[model samples]
Target: MTRQAISSYKQELLDTARTLRQQIRAGEFTSTTSGLASGLMQGNIVILTADWAQDFLHFCQLNPVSCPLIAMSRPGEPLLPELGKDIDIRSDVPEYNLFVDGELTQTRTDIADLWNDQMVTFVLGCSFSFEEALQRAGLAIRNIDLGRNVSMYDSSLATTPSSRFHGNTVVTMRPFSPADAIRAIQVTTRLPKAHGAPVHIGRPDLIGIDDLATPQYGDSVPVHDDEIPVFWACGVTPQVAIRNAKPPICITHVPGKMLVTDKLNDELAIL
Candidate 1:
């Protein structure tokens, strides 16, 4: 519910990277990336060896909804200059989940020690970007308001497969009144990079989710009597691909925790 107790770095361009990297390097700021860096575009990270990047890249292209490619780094290069002036893929992110052979093995703050010449980092658009837009329009996101991670569920909807990468789609759920939900849809539709619009709304059953209270990942937010559940294609869907690919080594940001980019959400908005 609270950000790490570490002191935030001074507010400056260089300071931004310094602070962000420091927190990540220090094992602080390991929680979700939601509501942090208010105007920044947050990304879902997927790092794999170059040998596996081609297949994963193809998978993302085939399943754009769950894997909107934002920026990709060359093999072994940890710097993501496209996202920020001095971004370090190995340390800027708050937390990372390491997967070996499609199974989650470890979670850590930085991947510096694990970095290799064959590693390629993929930055995928995340739902957090549109969340700022929705809040700016005065819509209350239950997860943010409740100070809990957004609820994520693995759905029965299948994503287009690429070679070894294949799996069901994962979605993040938010509850909104019918009217607010309509506005949210309109507001979020502007940011295609941020999942665009709701894939499903008002019916959890349609997505094969049997219970609203039990999510496959992240925290569950309460749904009020009049509110309906609205679902957005989540960047977390890649985890399923990670499991399916069973790559020798893969690294990804933990659920909720994401890479904060310098790009503004408004810049990505489609008029």
Candidate 2:
């Protein structure tokens, strides 16, 4: 493809996010929206029956680090206009992991078939939003540099339980020199919506991570002896929570794949 053609694909992905709420509302685009829209906000998706929404909401409130709530759809309402002018919770996300009795059975590009009047969609901010800031600052993201996804590990830290939802906080890891690690922390701190600061630096043992080479989710990036491994709270924590919640049924994005949005990453900054 020509550079213009590649740029066109990127533009289509970015432009679609602006009207993603509309496309999703109309059932046009539904696939993992990762790396498509650069500065716009992307999120982890979760959906559960209305009967379970309360408990899930409580779970998020109880464990904000692993479950920061960005926006949630009212029961049966597919539209999340507050998140975007025309977002449809039913089909906006590119892919959805379907869990039956706490076990993921299948994956779909859209969840319109599973839509119900009593279903609620929860959108949680993702760390990918801050990758832009880190890159702009001259720090190389190992996953991005390697054209792969960031590595995620299920930590030993148990999240505070709420009713039926409880599990460990899954974390994403990146390697950098102590100096670059500090810079990454500073850059990511500005985007709390995208996972904020490092929860642990240098010592994986402190967080119950016995092995850094094997991740529970996503591909592992190499860590040079001179570089320290930095860990951040990940949106994938919800998957673990979902498995533990055992909600008759639940849905979420596959690890690494994320829902791209029109909201800018800078828009999430407090400063």
TM-score of each: 0.93, 0.88
Q: Write the residue-wise lDDT of candidate 1 on 1-271 in tens digits.
A: 2343222322343365457656866677787878877767889999999989999999999988889999988988999887787688888888889999999999888889999899999999999999989999999988988889999999998999998999899999999999999999999988999999999998898889999999999998889999999999999999998998899999999999888877777778898
Model 1 residue runs over 4 Å out of place are: 1-18
Which ranges in model 2 have alpha carbons more than 4 Å from their true place? 1-34
Q: Candidate 2: TM-score?
A: 0.88
- lDDT score for residue 186 of model 2: 91
| Candidate lDDT (C-alpha), each | 0.88, 0.82
The alpha-carbon lDDT assigned to residue 43 of candidate 2 equals 87
Q: Encode model 2's per-residue lDDT on 51-139: one tens digit a residue.
A: 99988899888877777788998888887767665566666666678999899999876787888888898999898888888888999
